[model samples]
Every structure is written in structure tokens, then in C-alpha cells.
Target: MKRKLCVAPSFNCDDDMEELNVAALSSRKESVAPLTAERDGTLFRHSLSYPLALVLRLRVLQIVCGISTLVMGSVAFIEERQKFNMGLGIPAGGFSILAAAVSIHTSRGWSLVTGGASVGAGAAGVLWIASGCLLIALIVQSCRTILDPSGLDNGDGEAIEDYRPSPRDLIVIACVQIVLAASTLFSAVVCARIDCTA
Candidate 1:
């Protein structure tokens, strides 16, 4: 009788290894998906065109602030005029509105002129810094008024959403002002650092 020899086929080992490799690759991809998504989200939030985005945001907020300030100033003026009283409140508020308007116009004009290049970036950055400082002042002022409920007397100098001024409006405005001020500050920093040459 001839001796029987049993030889294991090499294909079985290859198939097992291929299966394991495929499974490992799949597992790796699945495991990395959430992390990849999280990283992408973070980059998307932080990697925005800092200066441009800041400018745009500031433009919109400035418009809103200008309009609000104008309204408030007008109301204050009418009330004061009716009472035969003259004060700096109206003028100061009006000046704030004017400053915001000028900032908006300056930014728009500069963007149009320089196309966000190095030509006027320095001047623009300075202007942005100034505007941001002004915004910070406004934010501080708003905070003082919002934090102290008693700070608003007759709600004359305060903003209101309804017939009677409510603290809710002030709180909301304060929150928005804080956000705007922070964004302005961040924008100023970014503008200051921008190379503008590339």
C-alpha cells in the first residue's frame, strides 16, 4: 500500500488573511469617521476667512446698531424737546450712530478699493481696530445698563421691543452687543496680522 500524504492547500490561509485585512480596514474606517467629522467641523468653524467674515458681520451689526441708535436718539430728542430739556445723551448717542455709519462706509469703500489686498490693509486694519474699540465701549455701556435693572430710569435711554420697555429687550441687546464686540475684537486682531501680500 502506498503511504498517503496530506498537504494543506495554501489558498485557505490566503483567504483567511484577506478576510481579516478587509475587516480591519473596514473597522479602521468606521472608527475614524466620527473623529474625521469632528475635525472637519472644527476646521470649518475656525478656518473661515477671518477678516472678510468679521467685516461682513460687523457691517450687518453696525447697520442694526446705527438704526437702533438713531431711533433711540430721536425718541430721546423728542422727549427732551417736549420737556424743554437739553442734554448730552442725544448727541452722544447720535455720535455713536455716526461713528458706526462711518465705519461701515469706510469698510465698504476700502474693500471695494483694495479688493482685500495689501494696498489699504494697514489703514483698514487701523480703522477696524478703532471701530472695534468703539464697539467695546458700546458693549460696556450696554452691560452696565443690562446688569443693573435699576439702571434704566423710565426706560428713556433704553431700547424696547414693546410699548413698555422690558428688561428682556435689554438683555437680548446686551447679549448681541457682547457677541458683536467680541467678533469685532477678533476681526481687528486678524486684520492686524493679515499679510495681504499673497
Candidate 2:
């Protein structure tokens, strides 16, 4: 009877050991699952920072370009109306001013409101790209005007006079437009990358 009791106790102990091993394996799986999920979440969230940074950089450059254009346009309008290329200056200055304003608002996390509706990030990005394209076209036009020898003369049969865009001024305008174009292009690329990732 004592030998029978000892054998029964040994069988119970083997059962308990198997149960413990199963429990440990389940616990390990649960722990590893959460850890991998957390890592994946962090990676996805942080992956956007690179493109976002570029967008912000583009905004900053837009702001600077806007300010410069506004100032230059104001000066041309006030002091050099006769010599200023109104066709080029007006559009470039106007675009810059608008771009700066919108970029500033967007950078501050404000959404565009139309008919009491707010725009989404995707829509905003699309609008930004479109604006960038128009700005590039303006920049190209301005560059051509600067490079063309007969760009400064008024079309109403005006004689050559002291009031003319100096070579230095033309060069400066060309350079600024070039920089603006480059910045806009870079931002467009970043924005495109964001779209692709999405």
C-alpha cells in the first residue's frame, strides 16, 4: 500500500511540471508580442519627421523670400515705377506675399478655412505644390526678363533715359529668383516622398 501511494505522488508531480512549462511558454509569447508591436508603432510615427522637416524648411525659405520680394516690390513701386518691370514685379511680389502668409499660417498648424470648412493636410500639401509650381514659373519669367537686354524699356515708345534697371539690380533679382526656385523644388520633392510613403 505504501509503494502504491509513492507511485501516485510521483505521477502528480510530473503533471505539475508539464503545466508549469506550458504556462512559461505562453507568458513569454505574450511579453514578446507587445514589445514588437510597440517597436513598430514607434518606427511608423517617427518615420515622417524627415519629410516634415523638409516641408518646414521650405516654409521658412518661403517666408524669407516673401519678405524680400515684398520689400523689393515696395521699393520698385515707390521709387522706380518708370524703370520697374511691373509685369514681373507685380506677380512675383503678389505670389511671394501670399505664399509667405499661407506658409506662416500652415507652419503654425492653422488650417485653411473656406465656407466654414477646414482643409486637411493632404489638401494643403496639394495646394502647396500647386503654388510652388506657379512660383517657379514666375521665377523663370523674372530670370528671363533679367537676362533679356531689351526687357526694361516701356512698350509705349519710350526713349532711352537714366531710369533703367541697373545690371547689379538685375543680377540680384535673378539670384533671388533662382534660390526661390531651388527651395520650392526641394520642398516639392519632399512632399512627393511623403505622398509615396502614405
TM-scores vs. true structure, each candidate: 0.37, 0.49
The C-alpha stretches of model 2 lying farther than 4 A from their native spots are 1-51, 73-118, 121-126, 153-159
* Model 1 agreement with the true structure over 1-198: per-residue lDDT tens digits: 999999977678788999999999999999999887776422333443335556556555555554554454344334333321112223333444454445544553344444553344455445455555555566676567467533435557763333334446555545554564455455445433442421
lDDT of 2 by residue, 96-138 (tens): 4565455444442222121223334445555565556656665
**Worst ten-residue run, lDDT, model 2?**
108-117
Output the lDDT of residue 132, model 2.
64
Q: Cα deviation of 94 in candidate 2 (Å)?
A: 5.7
- What CA RMSD would candidate 2 show? 12.8
- In model 2, what lDDT does residue 145 have? 54
* Candidate topping TM-score: 2
